[model samples]
Target: MDSKIPQIIRKSFIKEIIKKHSNIKVQSGVIDLLSECTTVSVSYISTICNAICNRKGKKAIGDEEVIEVLSKMDNEFILNMFEELRK
Candidate 1:
């Protein structure tokens, strides 16, 4: 969403999600999942990133915020589990 967040990072995030959740195939679903997990509206996510990039000149969501959101959804552990699954 953030214009400064390179397309590659967004793509990578989507790819990682798909790789971790094989059953989630739709891009929209991925968006929904992110929204649900973060308790942030998908539109807000898009808007916030855009604002941050355009107005504040930030590249991506800060790691601390990212970690906090992931922690709320217990997704940090899932990411670790996925790492094991990958191996």
Candidate 2:
């Protein structure tokens, strides 16, 4: 998946998330680095999702696949966070 993640997530959205969650001010440079890291992480997950889909002979990527990947990676904290977000 060589697709651009910029279309899906942007720096402004990241800034908004930070602002919403924290009172500490963040520098533009740090925000830029975070944005880049977020992009890379999302891309990596997307790649894994694609591979999982291929192995399953599936044509789509959904939350189940994402949760499965996270579970396999033992990301219980993130999974729990997401589960809370759903409520």
Candidate 3:
């Protein structure tokens, strides 16, 4: 991950996805799709705040954990839902 990737930008990206989808049922599919495109996981996304703040490596995160975190932050549930679709 590049240090240049700003937190606000990441948050905005998530917000945009949520705005477009807004459905929790869609997370699994979205995640799968994303997995095919990148090495990011549900745990990475779920702990995004902590990872960003501490600059954690991608290898340390897991997909299921990210899903769990997303579940709690439904304010942008679509971002989480997209996780499943990624596959």
Candidate 4:
């Protein structure tokens, strides 16, 4: 997350957690997942989310789609999860 999380870790998380979850095929869920996880930083989350949504960094054309999805996901489950944690 800093300037040094290493590409390997990013790839692993994307492949393991982000990609494996079928419902997460929804673009915004990826952002919610990354943000709620905490140990990773938002900058790192953004990179991973973008990579996953774009599909291996080849589909830059979907950038707008990705933004729309992120806006929807950021509030739904992510805020709920944080509230539960606070309790």
Best by lDDT: 2
lDDT per residue (tens digit) for residues 1-87 in model 2: 446566346778988899999999999888889888877877888899999999999999988888888888898998999788878
lDDT by residue for model 3 (1-87), tens: 675465445545655677687864446456445544343553456457466435654455555445546666674666545665777
lDDT tens per residue, model 1, 32-55: 566455444445545555555556
Q: Rank the candidates by TM-score, best first.
A: 2, 4, 3, 1
lDDT to native, each model: 0.57, 0.84, 0.55, 0.57
Instruction: Give the winner by TM-score.
Output: 2
lDDT comparing candidate 2 with the true structure: 0.84
Clashing pairs in 4: none
Better candidate number, 1 or 2, judged by TM-score: 2
lDDT: the better of candidates 1 and 2: 2
Q: RMSD (Cα, Å) of candidate 2?
A: 3.7
How many residue pairs clash in all the candidates, one count each? 0, 0, 29, 0
TM-score of 4: 0.30
